[model samples]
Target: MKQGVLLIAVLTLNGCSSISPQECEVGDWFAIGKTDGQQGIASSKFRSYQKECAEHGLGSDFKAYEQGHAEGVLLYCTYDAGRELGQSGGAYNKVCTGALEPTFRLGYDRGRKWYQAESALLNLQKTLEQNAGTIEKLEQRIDDNTRELSVLKDKQQKQNLLDENRNLLQDLRQLNQMQGQLQRDLKQAELQFSLIQQGG
Candidate 1:
């Protein structure tokens, strides 16, 4: 108990020395700590605040801050909150401890994975759609060229049209290959995402 008290005192002192002028005057340390905790900010921020306040000849209210931080952490450390943060690609602040930490971490990990997979799937599908659009344009060009080739009296122009058609066909083939690969990737990502959602 003595050691713990010493540690707390040290932390308080370290955080108390750097208080900002505004914070010193406002003296709303509890609200500041609560906001910090809700935003998943590090506890070290208090130390910085302490220093800022100290420069203004003010002291930090460590006890009020701690009480508010605990209350804010309860809101932040929920499983749903963890999942939302992870899905949004936010980093863990590691403020939670004990049993709650494990559960929140589990949600974060799964949510992050799920978010990544979902994003991948969306990108693949979009690429596939773009490839399809390209293919459609290519087909239109091919048809137009074929018709033009048939009606053309000049041999040179007909040959040129034939060559263009061949090139279009080649591009179409490559796009088809890309579309197939994207479809496969989307399928795999979807499966993984589904599994994560179900398992979690």
Candidate 2:
């Protein structure tokens, strides 16, 4: 059992390791760094690579890696890249510097705002759907209980069903009012999302 647990742990660690044994042997530190930078991965990730490579008795070239990363960062820090990342709800690593940072941030913020507006509209729509479904269920239950009440011969059972139906009707009325309000809110959210889409 202990051996099995140890084997599983080793397999899990190997699966999660970013660098493979073959990659460590090839020692393409520059390309690895460039890829990380292009993906907006943090500089600290190099330490993780170092640790993993060390396990394979390999050492990384920091100078070559840094040079490659700087070049790759230039490609990653564009306004369009930032906008696309923000739109996809991706986090910024604050990698862009000097002149590049401002434009990237501007695009990211605008895209992020649009994303938030769209998310809000979707949430409201989902709530409206749930409210309508609940109202329908309550109405159906009230109808079923009313029919059962009419056919029930026992006095106490009939009275209990009547009470249950009365509560259900009250709940249905409240839900109807909520549904109306949700419809209004949805319309407003839709208008807001439209405005955002139009860059208003």
For every model shown, the clashing-pair count is 15, 0
Question: After TM-score superposition, what is the CA distance of residue 57 in candidate 2 from its true location, in Å?
Answer: 1.3
Q: Over the stretch 40-146, how does candidate 2's per-residue lDDT look in tens digits? A: 76667778878988998888777877886787788888788888778788887678888889988987887787788889899998998898889888888888888
Assess every candidate by TM-score.
0.75, 0.85
lDDT of 1 by residue, 42-73 (tens): 56677777777787788888787787787778
lDDT agreement with native, every candidate: 0.76, 0.77
In candidate 1, position 174 carries an lDDT of 90
Collision count of model 1 = 15
| Local error of candidate 2 at residue 196 (angstroms) | 1.7
